[model samples]
Target: MKRKVVIAGGTGFIGQYFNDRLAKSGYEVHIISRLNNHIMWKDHHGIVAALDGADMLINLAGKSVNCRYTDKNKDEILKSRTETTKILSTAMLACENPPPLWINASTATIYRHAEDRPMTEAGGELGEGFSVDVGKAWEQAFFNFKLEGTRRVALRMAIVLGSGGGAIEPYQNMVRFGLGGKQGSGKQMFSWIHIEDLYRIVLFMRDHENLSGIFNASAPVPVSNSDMMASMRRAMNRKAGLPAAKWMLQMGAAALGTETELILKSRWVVPERLEQAGFKFQYETLDQALAEIVKS
Candidate 1:
């Protein structure tokens, strides 16, 4: 029998891509989302029934963390991750025979500032802020779940770049109209990964049973904000000019309940564990990744 895979938030950006990839790879993919009035309880039970003789379970359901972290936004962020994970975990444990692997989505923002050094999975420091706290809570919820036969892998992803959604589309449009520039000092590190590589990494984790820990899913090369913006400008055949001031970012993001840290903070992260595990990146350079995204 072909392997069956269930994704909790499989209708979202990364989940959609992952589902498509798994389907193409011969795995029967099923998504459980709130859409179509698909309640968590009903979806969970249905998925459990489907997974009686299945292969993997991937949970990528959560609100986007890019918004302002106000009290309300913060609650949504925390609850979205924790609640979804909890529901899925409970369902899996209730299953007569759970899947073999459970891959949960995580973020690299959990890592603390490294100044100029890049963070690796082995001994990287975690950041201290609202976002970091949320990441901690999210991971903790997943860790607390009891699934006897399920192997878990937490993917600490970086800025995901793609065509329609994510950071690329807006930035690309801004650059196209000559409004795009570097944020803050332009020195802060921007660790990123192409959507293609991200999907590939997910597929890899599903296949590689030995990979059961936190994996930093980012490109091998970490670039500065200035370099990334310049690459974006080049990709759009535009010229770079002024950088967005720190105060301007603070003022703008303030209304959104976010601070300048979202843009100004430096996170020099590296996929040390993924590389060590013999995983390869399709786009290791910012320019190459930007070029591909633009062309696509």
Candidate 2:
């Protein structure tokens, strides 16, 4: 029998990449989603069956925070994370042979907007505000589960850059349209990881049985917003670009149906634990990641 691996929320950008990669690697990759295909989130018995004797379970089930944080969105964003987490945990509890490894999705934004220092697993401080609060509650729901049979890990991820449809595409469009210049003050730190590296980190943790708990999944070297914009411009062969002021960004964000914090926040995160465990990142710098992503 093939090894079974379950991915919750396997329809999003990151989830699609993981599903494709794992399926190609010959594992029986099953998805637990709200969609009718594969396994539905409402199907408790289906989920329990999927988790039965599975090798790994990766939960990425959360509503997108890309839109405006209205009251309805906020409620949905919180429930989508916490409720889905509880449902999964409850199913795992019902299984006689639960998955050995459970990797839950968390965000690097859980840490404060630090400009003076970088946040790491060993020394990072949690931040306040709506996004941070959601992250805290999400992790709390996952960790509150008493699953002695499974090794749990909460991957605090940074902004993921990749080809086609992620952070890179918009920047590419901006550089093409001459809006590639920095947003707001442009001094805010931008912490990011190559999508491939994020996938590798999951496999790395699976291989290293000793590794468990919270680990920040970001590139070792984070750049400022100005630097990130400059790198994007360079990769796309653009010379001069238009910088957006805070007010302009606010307007743009409102028009684009997204929040400005996604662009303006200083997220200086480092993968301290991954490095200490001897996991080498494929794309260590933003330039390297942007170069390949732009090429594609």
Candidate 3:
């Protein structure tokens, strides 16, 4: 019998890519989304029925954290992640035959700002920002739940790189127009992972039952902000230098209800746990990842 997998946010960007990969890998894919109309799967259900009888459950349901974090936006951000996790946990507990593995999505911002040191899963301080607080609450909600038969894995992901919509496209456009430069002091660290690797890692974790805990889903080599911009410029073949000041980012992001911290904060994170598990990154260097994404 083909393995059956249920994806909660299968219609979204990352979820769609993951769903396609799983389908190609010979799994019976079932996608569940609030939106009834999805091209990936015809069988849709509310959160309640979505957790029924599956080998694995990958939860990617959450509002985009890149937006401005105003009071209203913050509420949406917190509720979107926490409430979704709660719903999924409740549903999983009620299932007659719950999935064996439940891979919940998380962010790397849970680590505190550490410019001089890299954050690892074993020993890293938690940041004190609103976003970090939200990440903690989101992870805690899942951790607190006691699903009798489901093994949980919380993935602390970094910025994902791909051809479609994301921070990369906007940065690429800026570099192409000769208006690209590092934001703020250009000293903060930017950890990232390619979409291909991210999708593969999710599948690997789902299949490996022993892999349960907080795994940082990021590339082994994390680059500084300045280095990242320089690489982007090299990829675009542009020599323009248009760096934005800290105040400018603050003013601009304020319109969207977010602060400048989203662009300025340092998250020097490394995938220590994943590496210990012998997961090799397909694109370890920024240039390699950028070239492939740009070409695609």
Candidate 4:
């Protein structure tokens, strides 16, 4: 029988990408999402059945943090992540033959905003505020589960760049429109990973049974906002672009219905554990990743 994989909340950008990869890799892909067509989140029995005898279970369920942080949005953001995770844990517990590997989604935003140094799994400092708190709670919910039969890994993913629709499109458009000079001081570090590499890390973790717990799913190379914008401009063949100041960014963010923190936060995260585990990134540099993405 072909290997089976279950993806909770697998209807978004990352999930769609992974679904294609899994299908090509000959694994039977299953999705438990909020959508009514497939197995819904409220359908507990369906989820239990999907988890049984699966190779891996990747939970990427959560509300998007791209909106204004209203009280209602914040509450939904926190509950969406923790509640879905709790449900998955219960489903895992009910599985007669649970997936050998369960990789829950996490964010690099868990680490404090640092212009000082790169945040590693062993050395990173946890940040405060709503975003950081959400990351903490999400991880806590996953780690709260104790199962001897299955290995649990929390993938602290950085901003994922890919040919498919993701955060890259908006940034690309910014660069094309000549507003890509750099937001804020432009000195803040921008940590990111190719979506392909992010996918590969999941396979590496699943194959390497010794690996568990937290792993920073970012590239070894992290560039600054200025450098990234420069690369974007080069990729798009734009010579000069305008810069957005902190106050300007605030107005722009409000108008766009998004948060400036997504652009302003200095996420200097590195995939130390993944590298130490001998996992190599296909696109190690921003230019390399951007080149591939822009062409596609």
Candidate 5:
């Protein structure tokens, strides 16, 4: 019998990757989304029916936080994460045989901005403000419920570098356009993981029966913004890049309809629990990851 996996909001970049990999692994994958005709979120019965008898449930449903965090966008961003997870929790609780494992998406932004050291699950300090608050509230919703037989895990992921659909694509495009230089002081740490490694980490967690709670999904080594941009330049065969100062980034973000904090924040994070669990990353360094992303 094939294992069944239900992925809520699994039509995005990361979700597409998981869909492909899980299908190849012989797991029956069903995507629950508003976009899909088969499984609409408004229908609670449909969601419960899809989740019933499934081996695992992974919720990646949330509004994208890449744009300017205006008042309306902020409300939607926080509500999308919490409300979607809340619905899933409620549906699972109603199930007589709910998924054995429930993996909810979290962010490394939950930790305070640190240039001094990397934040891990056990030793990291929590941060305040909008993005951090969203992360905290998201995790709180995931763990607030007590499903006796279900194991829960929050994937506190860092910036994921992939070929087409992640943060890397925009930076790669900037490098190609000769604007891919360090932002602000360029000393902020950027922790990231390859898409493949992230998928493997999901598999690792699925297979490990005892692994529960918050796990940081990121590469072991973290690079500074300057180094990361320079590597992007090298990978894309561009020698010169116009650096963006803080004010310049702020102005540019306003014009581009995005946020400056996305680039300026120093998210120095590490995957300590995954390391202790003996999971090895295929693309460990920024340079190697960029090279692969550019070539693909």
Candidate 6:
């Protein structure tokens, strides 16, 4: 009798990785997604049925925020996260035997753009405006419902680095094209986690029953933008990187149809709770994580 794990909106980048890890761990994995073969999100009956006998539920359903933050895109970004989470909450509350543990995806951007200090789960100062509002709203919707037996955890993840997908490839491409340099001031902090470690963190929360509430999912060692770009060059065997100024980033982001915030935001986050819980990170530092990813 293997434990069943249902992933709501589990067809995206992080979801796919989690799905693979869960399946390999011998959990009977079921995906409630938009795919025709899986349980569709709109299929109310199917959602309820999926939640009925689950041991765990991990929801990673949301639109990518890699593009330009137009008004329409902003609305969709907020709605996609909040609404999908709401639906899962609705379904979970209705279940007599709901998942004992429920983990939802969250962003580290909820914290203020701080260069002076690192943001932790306990004492981090939250930011304001569009991105911050979105993060706050997403978490708000997730914790709004109270299921009797369910222990809820929101994973406030930083930029997840890996070989197959995520922020690594684009940077690699930039390095290859000789455009890899520290963007803007190069003083902004960049916090990140290896994807493999991310997998372990999820399991850690699931296995540790007492662990509940928001946890920042970033590596302990965050580096400056210049240092990261230099490391990227070293990993790629490149000699020099052309630095991009603030104006250049603005123009480039506009031309590329993406938001500058993705590059400009100083995400100085640290996983204090996870470490304090005795969860060891395989790639705790940026260079080590990058080396492994570059080789892969």
Clashing pairs in 3: 68-257, 68-258, 69-257, 69-258, 70-257
Return the lDDT, model 2, position 153: 92
lDDT of each: 0.82, 0.93, 0.82, 0.93, 0.91, 0.90
Task: Give the better candidate number (2 or 5) by lDDT.
Answer: 2
Per-residue lDDT of model 5, residues 1-296, tens digit only = 78899999998899999999899989999889888555888889888988999999989999999999999999999999999999999899888789999998999989998999889899999988999999999999999877789999899999988887878877877787889899999999998889999989888888899999999999999999999999998888888899989999899899999998899999999999999999989999988888788882
> For candidate 1, what is the TM-score?
0.93
Name the runs in model 3 displaced over 4 angstroms: 38-50, 255-258
Candidate 3 on 120-217: residue-level lDDT in tens?
99988898978899999999999998777778899998888887766587678767766689998999999999999998898778657788989999
**In model 2, where do residues sit more than 4 Å from their true spots?**
none
Pick by TM-score: 1 or 6, better one: 6
Q: List the residue pairs that clash in candidate 1.
A: 111-127, 112-125, 112-126, 112-127
lDDT string for model 6 (1-296, tens) is 88899998888777888889899989988899889999998987788888888988999888899888999999999999999998998888778788899999999999999999999999999999899999999999998776678999999999999888888887898889999899999999999999999989988988899999999999999999999999899888999978889999899889989989999999999999999999999998888988888972
Please provide TM-scores, in order, for all candidate models, with all chains considered together: 0.93, 0.98, 0.92, 0.99, 0.97, 0.97
Model 2 lDDT tens row, 1-296: 89899999999999999999999998999999978777998999999999998999999999999999999999999999999999999999999999999999999999999999999998999999999999999999999888897999999999998887867777788889989898999999999999999999999989999989999999999999999999988888899899999999899899999999999889999999999999999999999998888873
Model 1, which residues run further than 4 Å from truth?
37-43, 254-259
* Better structure of 2 and 6 per lDDT: 2
The number of clashing residue pairs in model 4 is: 1
lDDT of 3 at 9: 68
Residue 149 error for model 1, in Å?
A: 1.9
Candidate 3's TM-score reads 0.92
